[model samples]
Target: MLWVDKYRPRQLDELHCHPGVTDLLRKLMDTRDFPHMMLYGPPGAGKKTRISAFLRGVYGQGAEKMKVSTRSFKIPPSNSTTVECQVLDSPYHIEVSPADVGTGSRDTAIVQILVKETASALQPAMGDKHVSFKVVVINEVDRLSHQAQAALRRTMEKYVGACRIIMTANNFAKVLPPIRSRCLCIRVPSPTNQEIREVMHQIAVNENITVPDDLVDRIIAASGRDLRRALLMLETAKIKHYPFKANQKPPLVAWEEFLEKEICDTIMKNQTPKGVIAVRSKYYDLMGCMIPADVILKTLVKMLLKKVSGDTLKSKIVTFAASFEHTMRLGAKEIFHLEAFTANVMSAIKQANTSQQQGGRAPSPSGGS
Candidate 1:
């Protein structure tokens, strides 16, 4: 059991930050006709935790008793193939990740099937309570294909009366406009440095561990403002090196940052055929380590943008990054698109330099004799 899961807040009051959002949610529970919610924010910012806690608040302890099960659904028309999906269901509600359903056109069918199933079912009677609708939490809604999103929009509208949806996404813009307009968009911003530190200290107290103040500071800096990551790092450090030494750094490997900086430095130092070949090998090594190609590309872009100086050059590189990122999303082979991006960046840099040199070496006023 990870510390993140162990210490996860079970109620709204336990949230470390976003009190305003919590207040809004509290009011929403009081309303008889609360609209569907869409919580979007950066990763590890407590969107999932908050939503889970909110559900527990609205329903009861039974909401927390979640169990995962996989079920297969027959596709329409010929029904030759089936799409299997795992759902986290509890007495109060169920959670689904549509992206997990078998890939391709079947993904769209998964959304439609889930919506239909939820709409068709009616809640069982409870003592002194006769609720009619059940909650359905959809995580990573943005990852669903456009076709699936369209189906979701329709199902959401059709079943709006029987089922309540709470969609969580990291990128709100990627979500379709129809869905966004239908749900109440809630933004969960990342926690601040102070908020993260306080939560970590509280966790240490609860665990009966004595983490030094300086060490806590180090953890905060390394956590990148993500409370879940901070807690995990604290626990990792405790397991690796206990006794809580003063000024001890968090035992985080930071492999992602290291890889990003190494690749970025290599590109900045040399933009040539030989350099491209060398960087390509490094990328392969990274891939061998199981780092996803999209993650690699995103990290490299962040580092490369920092290294690039001129505004024009930076803009050009950004355009290249955006184009390659979209291509990576559309194409199956990520390595090809990522490597192509690196080559394109190298070419852009070389072109910028050539243009600068030509402009600087303007033709002499007098022709050569």
Candidate 2:
């Protein structure tokens, strides 16, 4: 199982930063009794884990009450320590039932068939008398089959007085309009750098992973507000090399230099337009090395915000930069996308040609307004 899932935050209070969101959730869950709430956020930004914590904390003893199927869904263990299970002799001669899998439409007819079965299995415990408070859950409800979602909508409404939905997704538009209208909506904004750093540090301490001061920035850079991704990077880095611990001198390069290297590394790949490869490579780099594309962008954003020499060209540069991100997400032919993006950046630089008359110099490394 991935370290991110393993190290997922279990309590609302433990979710570092975003206390505003946490505080609101706390009050709502405690007093308001949320109904079909939607939590939208970037992937890996603790959306699933947060809702899971809320539900488990509120209805753990009755967790099995919410199980749609007896079959397991390959959930990752929630902590760093390993768990092992061995085969045992069964006098009962038990038979194991395979889990229902895949999507509807194109996937298995069995998957479509099981939709009703799964819902039926869950419907009983979800019925009144068994449920005291609304069952809280966040899932990719957008991926539900049309029939399944319709059934789920009934479930939501039927249980609204008794249950609350905390569905989450990367794209909110994919969610069925009926489902979206039934509940409150909240955005789980991605964590900032300091928040990510604090998470990694806590996990490092809990797991006994050694971290160097210099290395912490690298982990934070790679996480991009995805705490799960950050924890995985920190664990893997510890497997490769330990970061400095508390009371020790931090890394020698300093935070500023780390930021510069991160940006250069993000864009300077010796690549031939495989933007998908580059983008995935960047994410993998963060997963394994703790360096992320957004972190690099933020450094450049600081430069642009500083209104340095290139700052004069920031407007156009930022525009094309956003284009680059959009193209990357849309699965354009990478070579073409990166080519256009890089050329646009270079064009912006060229547009500032008049500025060079002062010293023939590009912007200074020190970002400033």
Candidate 3:
């Protein structure tokens, strides 16, 4: 088992970082009318961990005993078509993601089917106990299609009294307004550098390894403040370079950084239609390898910001990137928007250069003319 999973905080009190958020969850557990929750944060920021701990806090240890099963459900009036969904089930709750509903054409049907099933389940009578409602945990709620989100909103309202929905997303902005308005939104910010260092130290102690200060700093730097990533990097380093050295760096792939540099340099050198054609192969290779468009755009923008010196030009470039990123989200063809972003930035750079060049050459008009 990966060290990340083995050392995951099992209970609410076991959580080391984000004490304030955990306290809020504990208080909510004490109440009888805890609202449906929407936990949003960066990936590996402990949103899921806190949710699991919160469930265990209210529903006891049984909530942690999870099992994965592939279940099939037929769309109403269509016995010919069925949706196969993988669900993580436990005694108190069942976790499902709309993305796990296979490649069925009618993806919306799976969401409706799951919601109806949860609503129809008999509410157990745990008189004076906290486990009255069955919890339905949905992972990656932001990735759900608009149609599925709409169906989920109606089901949420209809069964609000019987079942509780706990949704997790990397970004809450992607969630529908109706769904966002209904749930109590909770932001689980990423862990700080110091917190990540402490966690890494604790893991080192548990593994009976002596990680040097320089090595620890290297892991923290590579982690991007993600605790889980830091832990994984630490383990990877230990296995590859055991008997920890004083200056050993974590073994992590630099392909993202290299790709970012390649994209930015390609745009900077050739700010023309030819450049767009030149970079098409790079984008194709990435997309063909199943790299997400958002990741590509983000890395490109970040690299451009670092490589470009002028603040005004950087701001303009970022604005253009944002516009294209949003278009990528709404549209199906990711490469079009990505290529458009490169072309747009190149145009901006070329226009800026033209204005600068013209300023130096054009004669100034006489003030007293």
Worst 10 residues of 1 by lDDT: 360-369
Model 3 spans > 4 angstroms off:
77-80, 99-107, 123-130, 212-222, 240-251, 257-278, 326-333, 343-369
Per-residue CA lDDT of candidate 2, range 141-228, in tens? 5565665556556666654554445567667777678877877877887888888877767766877765665667766664566666
> All candidates' lDDT scores?
0.80, 0.52, 0.80
TM-score of each: 0.82, 0.54, 0.80
The better candidate by TM-score, 2 or 3, is 3
Clashing pairs in 1: none
Best by TM-score: 1
lDDT of 3 by residue, 14-94 (tens): 898988899999999888558889999998899999999888878878787899999887866666877778889886688
lDDT (10s digit) by residue, model 1, range 1-369: 888988888898888798899899878865634789999999999999988888777776777889999978788767888878899888767888888764457878877877788867876652123456788899899989998888889899889888889999999999999999999999999998888888888888888999888888888876778888888889989998899776677864566656755677778777787887888888888898888887888777777777777887788778877887787788787777767788778766776766765233222111111
The lDDT of model 1 is 0.80
Ranking by TM-score: 1, 3, 2
Off by over 4 Å in 2: 1-3, 11-34, 61-119, 122-129, 132-164, 171-178, 192-194, 209-214, 243-309, 312-314, 323-334, 344-369
